[model samples]
Target: MSDPAARLGLGLAAIARPAYITSGRSGDLGDERGVGTLRARTRELLDAGYAAGIRYLDVARSYGRAEEFLAGWLADHPEVDDVEIGSKWGYRYVGGWRMDAATHEIKDHSLQAFTEQYALTHELIGDRLAVYHVHSATVDTGVLDDARVHRAMAHLRDEGIRVGISTSGPAQGDAVRRALEVRVDGEPLFTSFQSTWNPLEPSAGPALAEAADAGARVIVKEVFANGRLAPGGGDGTDGARAAADLAERAGVPLDRLAVAAALARPWARRVLLGPVSVAQLASNVAGAELVLPSGVDDELAALAEPPERYWATRSARSWS
Candidate 1:
């Protein structure tokens, strides 16, 4: 197998904020979720990931100071300059550092949002930001059709930063296809895409493949279904049970199998690992190295849930 580290990227979604929607976070993060604690943890993960040969790092505005943490890390490690950084706009963190906040984030795809968030992101990430994405873009948001946003994104593209979109919800495929159709001056506005794709939620696969065919970079996120596909998660779900059985037969941990499955996608240019600790990162890295038995991928296909059901389960997960 090719080097797993080369195709892997570390995402700061879970570690940069005190609370997130990922399952098993209560155990993984414990009660020490203060800003300082998570900042330190983020640095530790960054150090470990870099040492392990990961060259891509993902963050976003709604990740609650993720860009700030990453900026500090970059400043402290000026000599380590080979990594590619990607961040997203369109959402502002409103959790207020409280787990019980009424809303964690607010999404706005208006040109004003793009302008404001871009300025904030650039202030923190500077030119090290390689790609800027519209966070959680959906068809209903109408961001794909907003000409003003496209012009701003095209400006960023002209400045050598790749403009992209990250899709969410059950209509991820629809969003991806719509993003692909967006053009600025006869050129495709989006050249990169990040979307949720895992054994239990592979509905976006075809659209992502089409993006790859259009020469866009396709990054896979939520490969473990926000921890549902991880060991001891999704305890009552049939999809989880099927995945667990497959992992046992393959002689790997459930999370490892999940990572392996995401990496198995032919169109996936990079897969983001949202591990909260060094141990989990190591296991996920190991998964990237495993050569699955023949027909394992096909068998895993049976684990997919109806898109609506899969998304409903994800939406119902509590912030921890």
Candidate 2:
């Protein structure tokens, strides 16, 4: 295997490593310290990621001003270059910054939602945006089947931007297959893809491999199963212990082993690091340094939970 930390091209920019930063907790509604504190913390994490040699940042319109926070960070660090910014559309943040909203985000895969969210993202990040993806494009969403939405995405690609779809739900493989078949003017409309691939839900593996082989940048998300792979998380008790035992045998931290398994996949061009704190981000970075023994991935696969069961656990998790 090549050095995982070496620069790897994804779309218009070359990500410094196979690991990228994701603003999963940076815009949390549960953090009651107000926007000031949240932005400050997010800025701090971004700075840490940059300093740690991360060159890719993932944000979304539904991540509650994540683009705005990143824009501010960019404004402050005007000299920073080679940093690729990837954001997503198709979901609107409806939480209104309140911790107790009936819902946090709502999904809409129509052309109107894409146009509106594209404008919002452009206003915030402007030309710094690198790759723009459709948020949670599942087979049931029929985003790829919608001609209007597909054409709009192609138009964005024509504007010197790489367009892709981030898939969720159990039918992610089907979504990936559909994206691979989408074309505009004899060219593939999407050049990148993001999908969940963790020990519990490795069902997307074969399709992701096919996407990679078809020349699409395959970015892996939810590798840690949204923190369930972490020690003592409530999602999987027995699996967590098994992970701990495996990590101990490998002489690495449990989280590092979890992330390394994702990195080890042949199709994974980049794995999004959804760290909530600076320490967690550092640990995720260390995942690149891990050199797990043979059969580690197979051992981890034994802990796999049913796809529906895995997603159900993730859905029940608190945003906090």
Candidate 3:
């Protein structure tokens, strides 16, 4: 066996198993049970991921019918319990968006709503949940410090759930910093921080590193730059070459290189990926075992240098 945490160098290469196999109204992957092709094809991906030792499972309430799909899948297949399942709350899905809005963008973080949403998990997801989040990705400077949300989260933690926040969007790093600064009776606010991190988007690096120094665990999302930075894929040609060359040199696939790069970063405590199929999952875990060619990062960083959209300037300057 490997160190799991250490071999990832940065952390383990976790198969993200995206809640959304396809985009949904909530900005998360809507469920795919209706997708006839997916229904028949993904059992291999799940089996392969578990065989490859991926131990973390991530999904959210607003991610289409993800929880329902997971429940159905796991119920039919009881062999997939070795991994930890983490889900998020604090948001709702309606009107083609997944933001928190009780009535026209107010953003519900009330202890009442939070608890209601939390309980919904057991109903839709059964009792396999291993971690929970405050849905930090939906929060901003406007509501990061709310008492109702924080209090309910604290209550959940005291009850023995591994509570954390899911931060996405521009000011994600700042959100991580703020989440880190929060404390209860002098104790830290969160145990883990999930953010968008990849070679193309290092926006979370500063905060992630700071959190690492502060002894907080880090779980990285967007390890593949939302699937653009992976092998044989991308909207532009920017870092593709560097990624390909490095992938070859490392004797690993491009997507694996992307994931391995994340896992290898000191501040990165976990690498979460979204594998649409089982082969992809197997390929990802195998790639994690590859050691990058010397200085491949320099090439990657160079190719990844050109400024672009969210994928390039990963920094979240939008929170204000």
Candidate 4:
């Protein structure tokens, strides 16, 4: 198998914004959420991740100026040349940098959303943007069936940028399968997929495997389940308690165990780690190096919750 570190990507979701839905953010990020503070922090994470051999950097337009922060880092660090950048559109950040905002992001998967966001991303990230994904694509959204959107994505592909989709919710598998059938001029439109697939939400595993078999890049996000699987994190749910016990029995940290399980998946070409601090980043790197013991897989497999229940719980989480 290839070295796990080579397959680990640093995701800017947690660190790019002040308030997020991930657990333990109050402790991880503290009260300093000014634009300058986050910009500096993003630079620190980018530097640390690059030094640790993480080449792929994941971001999104809805991640509160994440593309802008990444662009600034790239400009300052011209010597680092081997980074692969992947970003998502379809969601617009509406938090206004305030934690009390009723809405943090607004999702729009229309051609208008793609056109506007793509222009912004390209303006900031330029040629460094290698893969552009339709953020949070779902079956009900009809983004996969939109011919106008397909043509726009195909144009991007023609310019050498791979078009892809990042799925969310309980229907991620369905969305992934639908994306597979999306063809422009008889050629496959999507060549990469990003989806949440922690031990608690392995519902997308089968469809992701099918995508890999079709020669598409598969990136696993939220492997820590938005901090539910991390150490000292999680609500008092049965799955959370079971995961804690299993991690203890495996003699590894909860987050590391979660990461190892995600990495162990044969279809997971790249597993994204969203760490708020350098210490967390180091721990995540250790997770990539971990080798889980036998039978632990079965224990982890048993921790999965019903997709609807799991997503319902996720939807209720408060952004801090």
Rank by lDDT, descending? 4, 1, 2, 3
Off by over 4 Å in 1: none
lDDT of each: 0.92, 0.76, 0.62, 0.93
lDDT of 3 by residue, 1-320 (tens): 26552233111112222222122212222343243434434445555556666666677765544565566667788876666778877666442322232231223556776778888887977668767876764444444577656766777677667777778665677788888877765666577777777776676788889988988777887777655566655545455556666677767778878877877787876787676655556676766776767887776666544334663343321110
Residues 152-176 of candidate 4 have per-residue lDDT tens digits of 9999999899989999899999999
* Tens-digit lDDT track of model 2 for 1-320: 25554322112110111112222343422334467866776777788777777777888888876777788889999899778889999988777766567677889999899999999999999988889999999878878888888888888899889899999887889999988998888999988899999887899999999999999998888777766676444243676667778888888877788778888888888888766567777887788878778998789889887878767766766644
Off by over 4 Å in 4: none
Candidate 3's displacement at residue 162, Å, is: 1.3
As a whole number from 0 to 100, the lDDT of residue 266 in candidate 3 is: 76
With a 3 Å backbone cut-off (N, CA, C), the pairs that clash in candidate 4 are none
Query: lDDT, candidate 4, residue 112?
Result: 97
Best-fitting candidate, scored by lDDT: 4
**TM per model?**
0.98, 0.90, 0.77, 0.99
Q: Which candidate is the best by TM-score?
A: 4
TM-score of 1: 0.98
Give, for candidate 1, the lowest lDDT window spanning 10 residues.
227-236
Candidate order (TM-score): 4, 1, 2, 3
Worst 10 residues of 2 by lDDT: 10-19
